[model samples]
Target chain A: MTITDELLRNNEQYAAQFSGPLPLPPSRHLAVLACMDARIDVYRALGLNEGESHVIRNAGGVVTEDGIRSLAISQRLLGTEEIILIHHTDCGMLTFTDDGFKQSIQDEVGIRPPWAAESFPDPFDDVTQSINRIMASPFIPQKGSVRGFVFDVATGKLIEVTV
Target chain B: MTITDELLRNNEQYAAQFSGPLPLPPSRHLAVLACMDARIDVYRALGLNEGESHVIRNAGGVVTEDGIRSLAISQRLLGTEEIILIHHTDCGMLTFTDDGFKQSIQDEVGIRPPWAAESFPDPFDDVTQSINRIMASPFIPQKGSVRGFVFDVATGKLIEVTV
Candidate 1:
């Protein structure tokens, strides 16, 4: 059986004890932008229960245009106020460069990607970068408390980055 | 105290019980693209542990160009072979059209957004659209097991979209 089938079975188990239909808006009035790293589970790391916060994630958690789009919707439509940015130590984004990644894809596919891969050199700097993007965006309101942190995968501690 | 402080306390607790750093690549070789809805915890819903799969999320779970970028990275560098796309019922994406959302924002901010809101009328059709986007992208090499599902908000169950 495929791993997808295995996860489907797991979903059946999840649904068996699941109690939901929570309100559409996040109850905590918070939103988090985190990396799509397999090692960091956003909810458990933040002690979040279901429906507590809106969680947006991508490859580097770099707050790309799409991240702004998600955050804008979270604050404008949903009732999220505070924003959290989580990048992690030992992130894959740190291992590569944007130009090299795009070029590799272009060499293989014969057409260069129109977008940057958003590779970053450091998680701490990228967290600050993400916060700055949110602060600079006219689309995202309620930026009074946007904080950024680097999650240490080994210790599972969140070290805030003061920019 | 700010909710960020509250969550920082929670992170301390998580760290107290934390385990060591896992491998960078996903153990299951899987990737999940999901909505940034508060109620749907992708790891819990799929019964995935840390380091098992990459979870990429955004506002509508729509496969935008960024999603393609992430999936390409996941497959090319990270070795993820399976992909799962998740959209949910009662999603905010269903509440408005792209033009209306951008127009409202433009009316308030005096500059229209260059990106579409990616609002959709139905979760099922959007799941198909997401699947189609993945299938059509050449950057993402693995198309054999790209499955899409509509997460039922009330039921907390994943319903596969047969597209």
Candidate 2:
């Protein structure tokens, strides 16, 4: 069966124990920008429950323009103030540079994508850089308390990055 | 205490019992783009284990240029073949309009964000549009089997959008 069908069947069981809606605004007034790595369970890793915080994720979890835009909307409109940026060890981003990844895509698809990979050599440094990007954005109002972390996928350990 | 500190303490306990890493590429060869809504547990709701699938999330999980870039890298660089786009009901994105949210940010921050909020009226339609956006992107190699879903925040039910 397709993965979608498999998930659909799983959701049938999930819906059987369904609970209703949570409020629009997150209860903790927080948003987390992290990698889309399958190993990092943001909720279980960080002790977050439903309705506690928004978890924004991408490939490298780099705070790109679109990520900044999401955070801006999350804070400005949705009432989430604090931002946590997390990047994980052993990420696919560490596998190649932006140019290298783009070239690989070009070779495969016969076209160069208009976007960058935003790859990083060290996920720790990337977390700090991402935090700085968020702090520097004119859109984010609450830059008072921003933090970054490099989560160890091997150990499920989170090491704070001082940015 | 700061949220970071709270989470760090939590991670300390988590790491104590943690095992080693999962493989780099997702075992299921799947990637899912979903909302960052705190109520939706992407792992639990989808019955995804570690290393099973890549879960890309943002405010509304609307596939943007960067999101497409990530997917391109995920498919071209990695081996993921299927794409699933999911948006949920009672989303914060549904709470405001693009112009309205931009104006609010402009009023508060003294500068209008260059990015759009990407707000949507109906999440089902939004999911379809996002799926189309991903399918239209030239970078994505596995656009043939793309699917979209509107997850019910209340019932934990997934209604597939036939896009």
Candidate 3:
């Protein structure tokens, strides 16, 4: 069966497994900021179960305005004290040229490039750069600790990039 | 060079190319709620650029309490009105048994399993179910739309699932 079909079936099973709120374990409440690359399975990589940590993902794993905003809120309201930024290998963000990506989007959907004035950033090489970018940002909570890592999609191994 | 190296290098180039605030595109302020599986590249998969969308990720792409809380803020404060949920294949959430995962954590880290009360809910079959759950949720903006999809990690193709 397709992944979608499989997931739908499982959800039904899960809904039935618990009649009320599935009792969640008390979460240590760590927050992770990582890339949205499909290869990095946060739960498995961190060996976490439900209600353990809050994970936020985006392209390049860079801390954008919204990312920072969310992180701020997570720290202020969600009880997340630690942050982990996980970037991965062979990210398509590195493969596509900015002009090419814009052109492809324009051609596919018949919509003009939204941010034609802005160029796309390439995020390949020294994962620490992205980590540093996030750490350097003023939006992240100054008091909270931030960690960075490179997750190898092929091997499922996580290598620490920065502390 | 390895994909990780390439991504870091590419990010530098990307940063150099777009040095200022990106002009927001019309209808570009969207929020994507997707899975944390490593195989999916949100930027390439959905043709998104740096300032286009806010991506919130978790296991099974499920909209947990934190996700809903973020969605409220993203919609109310961050100009995000749309939501997309993407789940993918060969998910570790499907293969690793909850007991195995918990036991491995105990063995490796010397910490007790946090969610000792419940088993890890298989997420492969839970994505669509999660989608439905999100749609039915009262916290999501009533006027906003939620889209669901299952991405084939092996092929890098996206198939739309029901909303």
Candidate 4:
């Protein structure tokens, strides 16, 4: 997809403001797992500058197999010792049932999408649970810390749910 | 990092337009790994409407170990078959040496961050090299497709560098 002229201009301006490589502050080198929903501006939500944290986003901000693997690598190799999983209210992942979603696409397209596994996974309700699962998984670095939160889309407020 | 009132109003308008799950036409579920630069608008860059694709962002958009892991799950479990890796020009990841970064942060925060690895990794001149590394990584699903591009912050243009 091509970027809109307005967005292109905004990025140009943003790039112009920073002169050097950002200093990765000692207490702020975090890794965040957040929803892909357009409403969530992770940088603003976390009070972060461009390079302070690494933000990973997916449909529900849920930690799936790949999420776990990435978390493992982030802790073990990418210099991320803390993880914040940010799920949010009014999340699309919570709105549709798995079968309903698959059928909706199937009706529009002839083939079923491959990732339509055995079930539709709701990321909002499952993020905290997913965090626990990830922290317990063998892949995560033993010393790394993982926390979870729910961002209020309506108010743009972040409330820590678990640590 | 609070979202501006203008953004919130725009988001509300955008949300009002979609009342239900939008259909994902064939090959519509694009998976993109982009940098977490606030300048980059993943939706606008891709001309994406609500619920069109899954965007996974991180520092530099470099397909680090975690990026691949997330890609694997996105393809294998989240209905994403195509991958797009977007790295931009004038990236913060390029500016500082590891030592400079660490020292800058320590001087400001007093404590060293736990994830402080040896140094900051640069993927600037090695755009093609970085893409190849991801395309070759085992963490990505074997059956899925992968592509990479470099977004020029100066021009607001995305140049397809590899496939």
Candidate 5:
């Protein structure tokens, strides 16, 4: 069976006890952009529940044009005010570079993508850079509450990164 | 005091109970692409824990160019074989159009972005489209295990979409 079948069976149980219809805007007026790493549990690590905060994640949680577009809507249409960027230790993103990865894919598939890998050497520095990216975004409003953190995957702890 | 301060204070308590070193790759070998809706508790809703599934989320989880890049790396390098696309009802993406949103931003900021909002009217159809996008991506291998679902924000249930 596909994972879809398994998850559907699981959702049957979840729906049996479903309790929802939460508000549209997050209660905390906050949004988190974090890595897609499996080891970092954004909600549990940050003590968030449903309807509390918006968790926007992607590889490395790097601020991209698409991310900025999302954040723009999150602030303009929704009511999110604070932006938090979280990258994690032992992230797969730290394993490769843009040129190196593209070259590898080119060698394998005979096609080079016109996109970026957005890899970084250190999670700490990446977080700082992401924080600055969001802060510097013309789309995001005047919220000086932008910050970044390095989530320790081994320990489930978040370490703040100053920019 | 910013939200950063509050989160940092919370992280201090969480780190006190730190346990070190989970493996580098996800244990479940699954990757989930979903919306950044505040009401969807991805981990709880899907019964996922840290170190299980790689969750890639953005505004609508619509499988952008960047998302494809991330998924390619996830499968090629991280050993993730299955992918699940989850979009939810009452999503903010349903509430706007690219042209309209771009015009609004241009009015407000005097600079129009070169990005698309990637808005969709129906979450179910959008999920299917995303699944097709991933499956059609040349970078993604012939996994044939990709699936999509529409999560009920009001019911905490995920309904599978047959594509």
Candidate 6:
């Protein structure tokens, strides 16, 4: 079986033990944006119960335009007030530059991607800047607690980015 | 303490029993894009072990340009071959239209968002269209298994959206 099929089997097990639907809004009134790294399970790391928070993730955990959209919706429609942003150590985005990645794709596909690859050299710097991006956005209503952190992959400890 | 502080305390416990840094690339060579809903824990739902797959989530789990960027990076740099797209029932996106959401924001903020709110009438139809978005992208190298599903919130079962 393909890996997808294997996962479907896993889903069956999940469904068997699953409970009914929960409420629509986040219980903790929190929203978290983190990198889509394989090893970082946001729920466990944050000790979040199911239905407590909205989890928004992407490549570098950078606050792109899409992230703004997600955060806006989270605060506007869903009653989420606190925002947490997580960028981990040893991210793939640290491996290359945006120009280089775009060039590689352009070379292979004969068409350059217009969007920024958002590869960053430093996770902490990116986290600080991402927070700024959020604070500067008029779309996001709640800027009261937009905290940023860098998760250490080795220890699984989240170190707050304080700059 | 603020909720963020409380979560930081939780992280200490997670780190106490936490394992070391896993590999940067997903061991299962899979990537999943799902909604940012609090109820759906992608790892437990898919029965995925940590470090097995890259989990990308956003507000709607729709294949926006940002989703394409994440998927392309997953395939090109991280070696993820299969893609699974998930939308869910009782979604906040289904409750409003793009125009209405944008208009509401415009009325409040006096500036319309340039981006589509990406609201849809049906999860099934949107899942189909999202899959088609992946199929039509030149950036994503692997279109072999771009499957889309709608997660039933109440039953905790995933129904494949085959249109």
Candidate 3 fnat reads 0.05
Candidate 2 shows a clash count of 0
TM-score, cand. 4: 0.56
lDDT of 5 by residue, A1-163 (tens): 8665776677778778888899888888899999888877887788777898888888889998878977888888899988888998888888888899889889998999888889899999988888778777788884667877888877777777877
lDDT digits (tens) for residues A1-163 of candidate 1:
8999999999999999999799999999999999999999999999999999999999988899999999999999997999999999989999899899988988999988999899999889888888888888999979889999999999999999999
Query: Which residue ranges in model 3 land beyond 4 Å of their true spot?
Result: A1-6, A18-26, A115-126, A142-144, B1-163
- Candidate 4's displacement at residue B78, Å, is 15
B61-85: candidate 3 lDDT, tens digit per residue? 6555445544544553345666667
Residue lDDT tens for model 2, B63-134: 988789778878877799998888998888888899998887788778887877788999989988998788
Point out the worst 10-residue segment of candidate 2 chain B by lDDT: B135-144
Calculate model 4's interface RMSD in Å: 8.5
Query: Taking the tens digit of each residue's C-alpha lDDT, what string does model 6 give over A51-141?
Result: 9999999999989989999989999999999999999999999999889999999999999999999999999999999999998898999
The 10-residue segment of model 2 chain A with minimum total lDDT is: A108-117
Model 1 regions more than 4 Å off? none
Candidate 4 on A45-116: residue-level lDDT in tens? 554554456666766676765465445445544466677788877665654566665555456545454553
lDDT of 2 by residue, A11-81 (tens): 99988987778887888899998898888888888888888899988999989888988888788777887
Model 2 segments beyond 4 Å from truth? none
lDDT of 3 by residue, A41-129 (tens): 45545655444555667555655544554454455334566666777665535544547755654565565434321123433343556
Provide the lDDT at B10 for model 3: 39
Sorting all predicted structures by DockQ, with the top scorer first, yields: 1, 6, 2, 5, 4, 3
Error of 5 at A73 (Å): 1.0
Q: What is the TM-score of chain B in candidate 4?
A: 0.75
Q: How do the residues B104-155 of candidate 5 rate in per-residue lDDT, one tens digit apiece? A: 9899899898888899999988988898788778788746688888898878
Local distance difference test scores for all models: 0.94, 0.85, 0.52, 0.56, 0.84, 0.93
What are the TM-scores, per candidate, against the unseen true structure? 0.99, 0.97, 0.49, 0.56, 0.96, 0.99
Across all models, the iRMS values in order are 0.6, 1.2, 14.4, 8.5, 1.4, 0.7
Clashes of each: 0, 0, 31, 2, 0, 0
